[model samples]
Target: MAAAAAAAASPATAPCFPSTHCTRPALISLRFSRRVKVAASTDNPSPAFNSVTAFAPATVANLGPGFDFLGCAVADASLSLGDTVTATLDPSLPPGTVAIASITSPSRPSLATRLSRDPLRNCAGVGAIAALRALGVRSHAVSIHLTKGLPLGSGLGSSAASAAAAAKAVDALFGSRLPRDELVLAGLESEKAVSGFHADNIAPAILGGFVLIRSYDPFHLIPLSSPPALRLHFVLVTPDFEAPTSKMRAALPKQVAVQQHVRNSSQAAALVAAVLQGDAGVIGSAMSSDCIVEPTRAPLIPGMAAVKAAALEAGALGCTISGAGPTAVAVIEGEEKGDEVGRRMVEAFASVGKLKATYTVAQLDRVGARVIATSNLE
Candidate 1:
């Protein structure tokens, strides 16, 4: 809840887009069987519930060297921060119509209003549509209401949270039969509104814990189990500003050097291994080693280096830009050290960077997105 201002990206060679650098083993697509017919039943042709509300946790994409391929959920007892989506089915409305009834943020109303009402331009709307499409429910209309908790464009996976919550909420209202990965794809449909098909944020927000996006063509995801004893503590410093995903991505070079590529590949492997083994020291060192994207994006964030150095000096294992820019994450050994690292991060931003910043201390969220509430309106 403390306010302190802070800010890093990738080391791909040939100036390649960070996503393209994450090699895929294959580029196959999943094919579904022909649609099936459902027999009418007076027992209950409609879903059991009229409304379903879901909560999706915020995520940190990239996590240093894992650019566009790695991310983890950020959750804490006091920081139940994310986006919530409530979906209500209206049988009387025309088929194939998804309406965004309202979007509101009790804490930040202006931001809520800023989001477009169009389903294609809005994450929650797109999520609902994708879910319905997956369920073959074109005959029914669903009204979506979004309650925003995470700030938009703060590099905390704001769009992904909203999209994941909407996808989960809609699926729950429909019956919750969709496979987990199917639901994730539905969420990914919404993420396209942000620019590309990157799932570093979307996958982790939907699956929880730490997620590695192995491929996007067939859309494969692998969730890694971290050591319980390691207990990853995160200090997130976000400035009162906006760094659109498109702008940040545009800042990347079209390619990178071969030498940079080799170094980046090695560091990425090390970071992944560190996470799996619960080696805090190794994880921190590898995370701070992003040579490509972070360097290009550093000038966009004032005092980025100073804030990162401050966090390290305050006992943080490593610090880097959360995703895009402006929001910085500091990995610490234990929850007890969160306050010190966070304070130093913010102080550095304000004094050295001259930017006001706010931060929160949280642990990696293992639960992902889920239906928090449901109701029947008879």
Candidate 2:
């Protein structure tokens, strides 16, 4: 059943027009060219809930040397912090079909309206459909509504949060039959649709805390332990502009020198060791040793160099671009250090970079995605 659903929702059959680039804005309309169609199996007749709501945290991907492989969820779930998705089963529509009613953001109405409304085009909508189809609970139709906390194209795993929340909510509404890994895969469908088929951001957004994509062939995810003694904090600074994931990925080099590959591997190993040992200083220092993608992408974000230097000077152990460009992340020792680093980074962006930016402090979220509420309407 899951295989059939995955095949139907596959991106290979999804539409893609010839274009110069695959930026986020450019890909929004492209999704309308295809639709996910599945047959409702008669064996399963489970009663679905009238409504379900779930929340997922924002994640930071490509933590330093662990490009396309590492990420962690932030614990904050404030209105402007992460995403919440609510799904309601619609009695009027046919089974095996889903629709998205609205996409809303507390701060950015224009951006919210600009987001795609089609289920095939929206991450949350696709995630909900995939989860329902995977569970074989096809007797009910549904509408998904997204409440955005993370800014679009802000390099904060905004799409992953929506996908994770929607998947979790849909699963809960149908009795939560799917296991955690299956839910992760459901959310991954959205990532594959919008971004590439990478699991760094999706895994952490669903499983919580720090996740390492150990292998791809078998799709293994290893969740790292976050020891209390580590005293870790994150300072995130998002600029005013957007850095589409497609463009950021396109900037990566097709190949690298043999020695550079060896160095990156060594740095990744050291950083993993530091994380395990709960050494904040070592972890911070190791995070700054990326030699491959960061150098090439750093120029796209104005004042990247100055902001990183300022963060380090203000007691940050290491600072680097979050996932792509435009948003910068700093690893600090504690809350005080994070505050100082955020202030300094903002100042650098204003004085040196001449760009206004917003900053926030967050801890590593251990709970990935969870159902916040459920209702059964008569």
Candidate 3:
């Protein structure tokens, strides 16, 4: 049933266009889970509470060399670039059921219409259901309403943000009983249902900071903290072109030589170390050193090399594709540098790629998903 539902819901399974590049497998098989000894709290639940709203920040995944394992949540001061989910209990519905009431994007109204409302197909619905199952709650039904703040296929962890917000909102509506890891697990399941089975995006969206998925089986996550003195700023310039996650995954090389693997592994380690040390320069250098995935995927995005070069020339510490493609992220230390780097990147996209682009300056979002509001029935 799950396989059928996933196949039916996944756009990657649809027939590819003659102009599209489709080579690798449509689906990824890396599943994630954590074995936690602590059980969810069920005592003294808020019986009167019936609704909750949660927001989860957008994430930059891969971070250069740490493909499929590293990610970090990012947001501007107002926290405007993320997804919101509202979970409301409906007693009239059947028990243990989850449904999507609506999906809307205030910024781009038409984008919402393309999304699915079916609980089995929608990320928010699947995430809510997974949370309920994790909490052992079977007596209540949930109706989810999703508000998308991030653009789809922009390499900003859009799906994961929605899934994280939904899981966090549903958990809060029931009494906020689930542990952080369990919340991540719920989001992971939702991401698996829609995108692929990877925790890099979901984990950081739920737990915040820089998360490294140490293991997939018996999933383990390591959060790296930034040094207090360092203030890291990211200049994210996204072109109008859409690079589907599935297609980007397909573009990746199936295998790499031993030397390249070792080089990438070393750079990944350096990235983690730089993050811990709060060295923006080293972090940027390490991020741009991704030889395998980046090289294979760069050609797929028009003007990518020029954009990266422009960023570097404009005083960016380093620059690379944010996740999949089209959204080039440049690292800088100061806010002023962020603006300059963003301008250069956008110009490169317009001149070289001939694609209009927009840029935003953001910082690391330390807090992941959180409940923004709650309602109690009188």
Best model number under lDDT: 3
Residue 331 shift from truth in candidate 3, angstroms = 1.1
Error of model 3, residue 17, in angstroms:
20
C-alpha positional error of residue 171 in candidate 3 after TM-score superposition, expressed in Å: 0.8
TM-score winner, 2 or 3: 2
Write the residue-wise lDDT of candidate 3 on 20-49 in tens digits.
122223243212111111123254244436
Q: Report the lDDT tens digits of candidate 2 across residue range 1-378.
A: 001111134432232211211244324433553335544544454656789989998888888888988888876436356789998887655566677767788777765776666666567766777777777765677778889888777878888888899889988888888887788888887777556778888899989888888886797888887786766778999877667777778889999999999998888888887877888887788788899988888877888889999998998889888877578999887787777789899998888778999899987788888888888866
lDDT of 2: 0.76
Model 2 spans with C-alpha error above 4 angstroms: 1-36, 39-45, 77-79
Better of 1 and 2 by TM-score: 2
Better of 1 and 3 by TM-score: 3
The full ranking of all candidates by lDDT, starting with the best, is: 3, 2, 1
Itemize residue pairs with steric clashes in candidate 2: none
- RMSD (Cα, Å) for all candidates, in order, is 9.3, 4.2, 6.2
For candidate 3, the TM-score is 0.88
Alpha carbon deviation, residue 150, candidate 3 (Å) = 0.6
Per-model CA lDDT versus the true structure: 0.75, 0.76, 0.78
**How well does candidate 2 score on lDDT at residue 339?**
74
